[model samples]
Target: MNDKVKALLSILESAGFSHDDLAGTVAELNDAVNDGKSTSIQLVSPGAAARYIKRINDENVFTARFRHSDEPDLLNNESNDERIENPNQDSCIVVSYDPAKQ
Candidate 1:
């Protein structure tokens, strides 16, 4: 997996998203990014991601839910597969990797 996949998986894990849901969400996000529909994504805290998702809707960037609570006595809270696009956020911050340094 590439950095994007790793980051997406990490974000989804932290947010409590299920493996099944994560599969679709990651695919969608990766598609958007690769197609130039959206910029790169940064893994953030769940709360922060939620807030940011709400703030950005329609235009550029978007977010996919990746976590849910595990409930034994009640139904689990499903991760929302919502995408938020922010026009203002139109840049991808990436750094060149040096394998020799590793």
Candidate 2:
């Protein structure tokens, strides 16, 4: 899977958020004038995604995911141990402004 998909799946798996729990998920993004809305079924709630990313970032499990071979940073003798410190900006998903996918 792509990094975003993998990262999210890892978060969900780690958080014990099963596929059933995703039924209530809404990809929302609220701003000063709008109450946020659903952008797509293929996306996750930006707020929730950011929160989980941050929470999991501190966990050792997430640290291993970052160093996994599929990512663009590792090899025989070198590695990048950078962590996900900014979930809001680091997440591949985009927030919405439409306020409703309904």
Candidate 3:
């Protein structure tokens, strides 16, 4: 695996995702590459991503924000102020990857 994939897997693993839970995500990423398109991996939940951000000691490898699924364009800043000020179950975290970037 490339360094980016390795890093992402490490983050997910640290976030408490089991290997079984990551199988589908791995498959999806492979499929996206085969099809020549960019892709994003949706974590198990917003809470899981939040846990990773809060618990992991690494310099931020991923950006987390609060975005309501229905709004799509409405995302809080990278600082996550909105998420902290107002938690919403309707919001979901979208983790997008740029494979071309090292």
Q: What lDDT score belongs to each candidate, Candidate 1 first?
A: 0.39, 0.35, 0.53
Q: Which should have the higher TM-score, number 1 or number 3?
A: 3
Question: Candidate 2 on 1-102: residue-level lDDT in tens?
Answer: 234334445565554556565534322211211333223222323334545545544542222122222232222232455443434333333222232322
Q: How much is the lDDT of residue 9 in candidate 3?
A: 66
TM-score, prediction 1: 0.35
Flag the better candidate by lDDT, 2 or 3.
3
Model 3 stretches astray by more than 4 angstroms: 30-36, 46-48, 53-91, 99-102
Rank by lDDT, descending?
A: 3, 1, 2
TM-scores of all models? Answer: 0.35, 0.25, 0.51
Name the runs in model 2 displaced over 4 angstroms: 23-53, 56-102
Tens-place lDDT per residue, model 3, 1-102, is 444455666776776667688888767765655555566665535355665654333443333444454443322333433333343545455565444631
Best by lDDT: 3
TM-score order, best first, reads: 3, 1, 2
C-alpha lDDT of candidate 2 relative to the true structure: 0.35
Q: For candidate 3, which ten residues in a row score worst on lDDT?
A: 74-83
Query: RMSD per prediction, one decimal?
Result: 14.6, 14.7, 7.0
State how far residue 18 of model 2 sits from its true place (Å): 0.5
CA lDDT for candidate 3: 0.53
> Can you write out model 1's per-residue Cα lDDT over 1-102, one digit (the tens) per residue?
445555645644654545664575466556655554543333223343443333232211343332222211111222354322442222211211222322
